[model samples]
Target: MYYFFLDDKMLPVPPPKMEVKVNNKNKTVNLINEGEINIIKSPGLTEVSFEVMMPNEFYPFALYDNGVSNFITRLSGQQPTITYAKNYIDGFEKLKTGNNPFRLIIARFNQKFEYLSDTNMLVTLEEYNVGESSEYGFDWQVPMRFKQYRPYATKELEITTNENGEQVARVKQTRPTTKEVPKAYKVAANMTLWEACRRASGGSLDWKAVAELNGIRDNNVLKGTVLNLK
Candidate 1:
């Protein structure tokens, strides 16, 4: 048996096919007095793509982890209608909107369901395809792409006293002490600073404080702007 999970949430039905692409960052060049040689560089992000099945009807082969949520439409105090397809779609939407990296785990097992090995990594959901298909009947097929996530530091200027007792400032980079958010956030188009902070912190961060720290008078920031969270 095998299990697939994104951010600890198990997929309802295992995809019929799963493909993982380990990207290459190597460069080929001609060196001085040498023929064409490969400039072997570090590996690129590992990409995983697969089409997950969402069963509209319950089948013995289908697995359900906890319950599905109706995230898109909900009146004031009403709960969402639980459906397998909607649950998976809700998870995907959260991943795309959260702007965070989560752990993806693929576990292997024997017929008895004993643990074997696991393919585990930190990944960010890149994109996903959603539409109705005749082949799916009343069910749904969602194709998703996830890329390995590597963290980076946020650059900031630090003031320090030199040996001559003179105050000096220097640029430094460091990760965020708080675990809830990233070291820095890259602003996307039509992205508000408030929304970014809210998503990054999982509602744990105060947007006003974050904006004050970044000296952002405008909540509507430009695209590609790196917001320092330190």
Candidate 2:
């Protein structure tokens, strides 16, 4: 079984297919005396697209918040179709007006109801097309597109007087000061005191001696902190 969710709310019907593609942000550069070469960069925004059908009538296979009972759907003072459609509409409104990107999750399961792997990402809705189908008569065909969202801040340039008394423009970094990794074994999320010593001394130095050399009392450490190998 397959299920799609927007912001953790499951969609009533899964789209027949969803397309995911990555935008290429690499650059082609020509070096001196060297032919053209590709400079690989971080990936660009990802795109997700699919077409879904919103039935006007409740089909037996339709799922309403994991409940397929038509009786339960009618008790909510709306048709099963309206129930599902309104949910999607609400999601669209949030995507259009919300300040932050919402989570998109796709879950799959085996026929025996065993849990399978899932994919989750933060995305911003790019576009959606709502069309009425004459053949389906009152059913809605919605084509939706979403793009991966990543937040960033732009640096501003400042006009400053140089040592020679000449005015020059300098880019001032506005983000919080970040520690520079001067060596190979800078403490990080994945690098601990023990791990750093192993790499710094290559298993030749003991942990206690390395910790004492770096003045790391009681093994207290934090990310971006440096451990001295000598």
Q: Which candidate is the best by lDDT?
A: 1
Model 2 misses residue 76 by how many Å? 16
- The TM-scores of all predictions, comma-separated, are 0.62, 0.58
The runs of at least 3 residues in candidate 1 whose Cα sits more than 4 Å from the true structure, single-residue gaps closed, are 67-82, 155-230
Off by over 4 Å in 2: 66-87, 151-230
Q: How many pairs in model 2 have backbone atoms within 3 A of each other, for residues 3 or more apart or on separate chains, i.e. clashes? A: 0
* CA RMSD of all predictions: 14.4, 16.0
